[model samples]
Target: MATKKRKKISQAFTKSQLVKEISERCDLNKNQVTHVLDEMKDIIASHLKKNGPEKFTLPGILKIQVRNVDAKPSREGINPFTKEPTVYPAKAASRKVRVTPLKQLKEMA
Candidate 1:
């Protein structure tokens, strides 16, 4: 048997892409840009889960927020993986997002 090799995709977009963007806008290295983005993900996830999403603004970046909502499980009655019939229970959850693009994005296309 033969195994196929797969290409590796850099995390949070390619390092080159991130490094180029960050380097063009700020005095940061490729490694620094990578580190900052990784840390930012942790911070965002933690805030949304623990303290709730907060509206924040970074230069040239959009505002972000976390919204809590009551989520209802599938009422259609079905087992997705097996396609068997079943009732899905309702639940709650918090959804996080960047809201700044709402208006501009809607207007674009």
Candidate 2:
């Protein structure tokens, strides 16, 4: 039996590249594209802060939700490098954002 090798995929889009691409597609200036992106970020942040861990969806694109995580209890652990025993302190609860692609986006992929 022979195994097939999987292909490696490597590509990334930076903020500047995103602005340029959006500007070109929408026939808008780079500044305008950047402004729109900035506004979107602000709007999402404000909504999350106000609502406290709710879902926000962009139709046919993606869904984003903020989640509140509970605190972790303290525990004893060892330092890998020094091989020394240590007491790990408890961690306070934190918030995290989760993203999920919508059906349309998933189909495209």
Q: Give residue 2's error in model 2 in angstroms.
A: 48
RMSD of 2: 9.5
- List the RMSD of every prediction in angstroms: 11.6, 9.5
Model 1 residue runs over 4 Å out of place are 1-15, 53-56, 71-98, 102-109
> What would you estimate as the lDDT of candidate 2?
0.83
Q: Among all windows of ten consecutive residues in candidate 2, which has the lowest summed lDDT?
A: 1-10
Give candidate 2's total backbone clashes.
0
Please give, for residues 1-109, the per-residue lDDT of candidate 2 as tens digits: 3344534536666999879867776778999999999999887777678454477788899998888899999999999989999999999999888899999999987
Best by lDDT: 2
TM-score for each predicted model, relative to the true structure: 0.45, 0.67
Which regions of candidate 2 fall more than 4 Å away from where they truly are? 1-10, 50-53, 75-89
Clashing pairs in 2: none
Model 1 over residues 3-108: C-alpha lDDT tens digits? 3453464666566776777655676677888788889877766765646546554435456666556576657677879999987767766564645655555565
